[model samples]
Target: MKHLLSTHDLDVPTVAAIMNVADHMSEINARSVPKVPALLGRTVASVFFEDSTRTRVSFETAAKRLSADTMSFSASTSSVNKGESIRDTIETLSAIGVDAFVVRHASSGVPVSVTEWTDASVVNAGDGWHQHPTQALLDAYTITRELGTGNTLAGVRVAIVGDIKHSRVARSNIDLFARLGARVTLVAPGMLLPAGLAGPGITVTDALDDVLPDVEVLYMLRVQRERMDAGLLPVGGEYSARFGLDERRARMLSGDAIVMHPGPMNRGIEMVMDPAELPGSRILAQVRNGVSVRMAVLFRLLGDGQLGA
Candidate 1:
């Protein structure tokens, strides 16, 4: 538990322990001041080689809420623009006493590479089509909170829809959900899902309608147009008409099923119906849980070691 490189590194008891700590963090978030002295005098550095909105801000806010000193590093403005290597940049920060690094990079294993250069604990925010551990943690926390499932997701059916080939969130969720005892079905077009993803506790399908009736959680992923160079989509409304969670398709889901999207959702593409208006949507709940889950992670890595399983 020295570093959080991937969800695959965590087991059931460990996940439950982290979720219990996050439950406390969630309570702190509900308070008027919403600040704690748990991480006083510790410093957290957010080094993002890729552009991000929700993750970067969430980590910074989590650090602040725990009273930890925080600094931000972006590739565009840093010495990276001057051709300084990532090792050099991290070594320089390490020399100044950074306690932990929350790293997001376009490269897959940048966070793991960073651990070789510094003694600071590394938390992977998001890597290129790799694991986004914190996002999956928050998602699991949100589901548990909304469904009253405690920390175990046994017998809960979750369907992750769209863009599986390019989504780090989907990868992390599949691992975390399966570990927490949930049955996961990946719903995407043939071109979107990578080969060799189906196995025990997991299934894949191109037809969303076939799985909608039984799924308790419908997690929609955005189409990563930036990641694809050529056109992977068909012309006009064909993709949406088949795959999008429009009002008509929304009605086909189980009555208590919840709709979830990570962020920056495409209005008419992946999600046609307004997520804010959806009755069982946990989109905003996921955002709030992001702060709590990150706080728990920081506390575990940098605070007292009591929370570790």
Candidate 2:
């Protein structure tokens, strides 16, 4: 794949290839020395136009695991402080010899525009409330490993809860899971949901309790107050009361059900209880699998095409 911009048009064969390669990368991660020479001569640059902790570090770690040289550009500390444009910054980095760019920005479609400015391969780390492809990738891998469901999620039932209007992860996951044959249900408050979100193989609801018992994968999302303008919900306590996954809802899940939340969780709001206390939690597994899945992505874009050859 030249660029992993979104999961919208990603084909099943390509998804299978990435998932299949991630299995090999996951094994490498479990080794005593989790390092490989697969990408020795390649250099990857992570350019984030916004703040991050997990996504930025995860991509760099993935690059390192494959022995790819890495560079990072922080907009806060870089020439961006001097009013440098994204195109200019990317052109500058390209001139410095980058083989790939893992880009994150606060606006949608930044990565797509970035492709016009450089010859290097581009992977959208994240762009606004649009998509976060690798996050969906790792979450898929984690769910597969957790459920022992090969590469496809044919019979699995997944419910994505909370802040769908502002969640890039939810957007990508909804596209990916449904395309992989999983039945998806999006649960959220009325105002939090974007228009035209429901269709074939997808369900939408404002009642969280009604779907709790039947969902096999309960994916939670934070309220994203940083992206909100005031007054979406009446009060924080009311939101927690209506949609939060507290101990009661946790008990509604079956023994095999897995609860997931992409990082930077709003502790008392979206998640009313500690995830550590829940036996079905795969939160840490998602974080652990991120490196291997991302390694698979980088290898697919930058490595010689021998994967599944």
lDDT of 1 by residue, 19-128 (tens): 99999999999999999998999999999999997799999999999999999999988989999999999999999989999999999999999999999899999999
The lDDT, on a scale of 0 to 1, for candidate 2 is 0.89
Number of backbone collisions per candidate: 0, 0
Any runs in candidate 2 off by more than 4 Å, and if so which? 227-229, 305-309
**40, model 1: CA deviation in Å?**
0.5
- Which pairs of residues clash in candidate 1, taking residues 3 or more apart in a chain or in different chains? none
- lDDT for position 231 in model 2: 74
C-alpha lDDT values of all predictions: 0.89, 0.89
Worst ten in a row by lDDT for model 2:
300-309
Cα displacement (angstroms), candidate 2, residue 57, comes to: 0.5
The superposed Cα distance between candidate 1 and the true structure at residue 223, in angstroms, equals: 1.0
Q: Candidate 1: minimum summed lDDT over ten consecutive residues — where?
A: 227-236
